[model samples]
Target: MKNNLKKNKEISKEQIKNYFTKSVSNFRNNFIIISLSILKNFRTYVYVILIPIAFLMIYSWYTNAYKGDFKPPELFKYMVIPSFAIIFLVNTTVSEWKNSVFLKRIHSAGISRINFFVSLYIFNFLLGIASFLISVTVMSIISLIYFKPSNGTFFSLLGLLEFNDWVGMLYSLFLCISISVSIGVIISGLINSIALSQSITLIFVLFSIVFSDCFLPIDLLSLSKPLTYMSYFVPHKHSVWVGLISASSQEVSWAFENPERPGRIISFGFNLWIPCVTAFLYSTLLLVSGYFSFGWNTKK
Candidate 1:
């Protein structure tokens, strides 16, 4: 009996190890397949992402130059970075689910749904980072050549060049992209039509931007109780505020409350860690929800 129990234990251990090994192997194979597909149609993806960003950057530059106000960092944080990120992630997510034939082929090949979902998430996230790097690099070059400092303040360009500020910008970018990709995945899973999914994602992002403190101050939230509650849910508000504050040299508090001066309300300062944690939490929730929401049926 003792010998039999020991043998069973050994068998169980081996089975566990084999399960893990198979999972890793499956993930690696799926990743390669996804990567190759992305490469084959790389131009389609690149054009979809780049055009809007280029347009936005050009508009930003023109407006800034006309007004004699060129702040690369603000332009990046406000418009360019998020434009590329949303376009790339949303389009990628929709494309993955739009074709029924592709889904059936993938399913028939014995690729597990979990593996497919993970591969899609990772691919989109990496694409987001790539788009961000490209956009920032291009914008940096433009700034150095075109932007002139009138008052010896190059906060935007400096933020990109400085080590600490650069890291903070990257950190904020990661969180922002993670949130966007997760939301895209969720939208894709829920909406069957590619057009609908893309539209919804765009609208959602636009709505978030409209409500974000970047456009409307959080203090105004007090005017409407419902708006105040809704403000708590907009991740863009947190993301933009965090990105701006992180890049700024000024000492900014994250907390909105002021104990010493109750009348003096702070909008952006709420402890730097709060947005970071909230973004992660929101992404995880969206990912889990998207995975569960994705239909397993391949037949259309």
Candidate 2:
């Protein structure tokens, strides 16, 4: 009897190990397949790399000519990074929703929902990173040649501590991108009509651009107490703050007031932890909702 019990335990252990191994393998295969499929789209690379670079160049020129500063402008980061992340990712995810053939293949192959969602997220994240590198390189070259920056170092425009600051900035950018990606996935899962998807995407874009406090300060917009507190719900608000904190390489102080815009209270400090925790929670919640809600309900 003891021998039989030991044998049963060993079999259970083996079965659990095999189950995990198969799951890992399946996930890896899904990732590789998704990566290869996305890589085949040359236009994706061009659009992702060029559009932002073009915008950056034009904005850099304006800043250099008018502002007389070649340093990376705050407005550019605020406008571009969030815009790129949302537009690119939302469209990508929506396209997947539109692809009936792909959906059928995934279902027939028995691909798990987690694997599908994660594969999409990771691919988009890596693509965002690629776009970032290309944009930075192009901007760096332009600054080196045309801008004649006063700092004498292109990296300085990104903020202090050179390498460390860049990492922080990238982390903040990735956090923003991650949140955007989650939003995209959730939108794709929930919406079935392409027209509706486009409409919603437009609304998201408009909000991120205008109301995200990108053009005007949130302080100016928030007249009521509820409106003031509600600004925290905007993802872009936190994204911008985190990027600014990372770039400044200075500790955030809530008491510090902007000299240019007086009467407005500062909303700095806890920059790192605030965005990190917020991103994690936002992504987790959205991804969970997306997974449960995903379906082949798109209009043909």
Candidate 3:
């Protein structure tokens, strides 16, 4: 711990002050230490990083065993997307307050907390996007080894939307993750324990899993329609839906609906657009609430 503390020191004030006066976006002004600090803390733990990685590998197996090409997207829509997104993105905000020395010093550093927080958010956003792409790439690569993707096939799921098309989805997921992590950070920040951060994280996972439609088919649960519709507003569910593509999670729709091996197809109109809109809205609502929560309770 002593060595860790000694390693985290920034350069002298003279350099920072001089660099600040010279330019806002200079390399010195935009220090890499912050980024290094984040990586050092978040990636140092083997378990934290590997859990998501193992989950992705499991997802690949599930996708590979799927009979239809589109089923890969279905698995992602229902399971992999939400699970992986939550694991990585939530790490940024949720586990922020484990260290007494760093947290206290940074909070009292006389710098703008909002700016500090925003820089952290930007890193999480960029990391989430990169991780998302990497997971999809890994899935695609694994799918190629065991599953064949033909014309308009499973791999084409990547091309289902342009980068802009996914902007809302990514933003929505980011906000959901941010809100969750922020709440955890506030608790951890106040309590100053790593265990508390994880405890809160478990509760959140329970909440998100319960509310998320990924647990069981939200439509097929045989619950009352009104109740089902009511549950759709939950933030994590909104995140899962936000990042969903146009894929159905059914084996053979006609086999169940028609009892014959009838061709099944997914409709793009409501299936795609609805999630895109709702996720953005839900994320916005959660983020707005989180912003207030962070201000009111996170600082101690």
Candidate 4:
């Protein structure tokens, strides 16, 4: 009995040492948990649940996008962006926050709050990249099936509706998800209840939809300039912009018969780079904040 107790003590000490010495592991674990949660509870997700509806929605907008002002794919891109913002990050982050003792347990294990944050930020970054690819793949296949490739015109990155723009949109999704997840982590870290987490996540979604140009273009709603600027701070804006870019790609010629709508207009006025940088930076800052929140002593 004495030997058994001694070995168990040594094992506990080693675990503590691992937590303190290798903070990266904590972040990796969180990242993994976030991803698993996404896969695990896809049923609750609107995208996953109503994918047929989403597919139909994407199909309609993509078909309508053929209008000279916008291509079917481009318009559909707009909806997809906000959809991702609301569904993926909100559901995953909030759920994890409420259930996981991620923050408290880490500190108990001897990992520093700052170190945990640093590692999680990196993990979130990589996680975003994976989500980007997954989302794009789903969007592209569904859109192309309906739109049918025309003259093999490739998509461009900056043009809002080009092949390259698709690539940029993919990156934008990656950036946006990171920002969203980071925000969730911070929110979860601060609040103790799953119910609270869900509410906050919903608010974030509402804010994102409002800030996005999809529902109310800045030109149309001149008063929202400040909100538009504020939107820059949110990942939802950038992610939506990327979708707009993919939709606006000029190579396909958005309108089938009516050519009056200017090409690349969506990409013209918007400062696409703002969302990119903001999402990247804000996510990092919030991720760190979440780490600290997790570290707060709970025995109080």
Candidate 1 deviant stretches above 4 angstroms: 42-44, 47-49, 62-84, 87-98, 150-156, 159-167, 213-229, 250-265, 268-270, 297-300
Q: Against the true structure, candidate 4 has what lDDT? A: 0.52
TM-score sort, best first? 2, 1, 3, 4
lDDT of 2 at 199: 74
Which stretches in model 3 have alpha-carbon errors above 4 Å?
1-31, 42-49, 60-64, 68-98, 146-153, 157-192, 215-227, 245-278, 295-299
Q: Against the unseen true structure, what C-alpha lDDT does each candidate score?
A: 0.60, 0.61, 0.49, 0.52
> Candidate 3 on 58-150: residue-level lDDT in tens?
655654445554433354543334333444334444345434355456556544545555555555555555555555666665556555545
Candidate 4 local lDDT, 1-300, one digit each (tens): 999999999999999999666656666665675456555665534443354346445555644633323343444443354344434454455456446575456567775556555655555555445544455555545445444444221132123344566576566655565656566666666666667666877787667755665444433333444554566665566656654544555332341232234432333244455555655666567555656655343232
Clashes of 1: 6
User: What is the lDDT for 86 in model 1?
Assistant: 56
Clash pairs detected, candidate 1: 253-269, 254-269, 254-270, 254-271, 255-269, 255-270
Query: What is the lDDT for 234 in model 4?
Result: 57
What lDDT does candidate 3 reach at residue 278? Answer: 68
The weakest ten consecutive residues by lDDT in model 3 span: 261-270
Q: Which candidate tops TM-score? A: 2
- TM-scores, one per candidate: 0.78, 0.80, 0.63, 0.58
User: Could you list the CA RMSD of all candidates, in the order they appear?
Assistant: 4.6, 3.9, 10.7, 8.7
- lDDT against true structure, model 2: 0.61
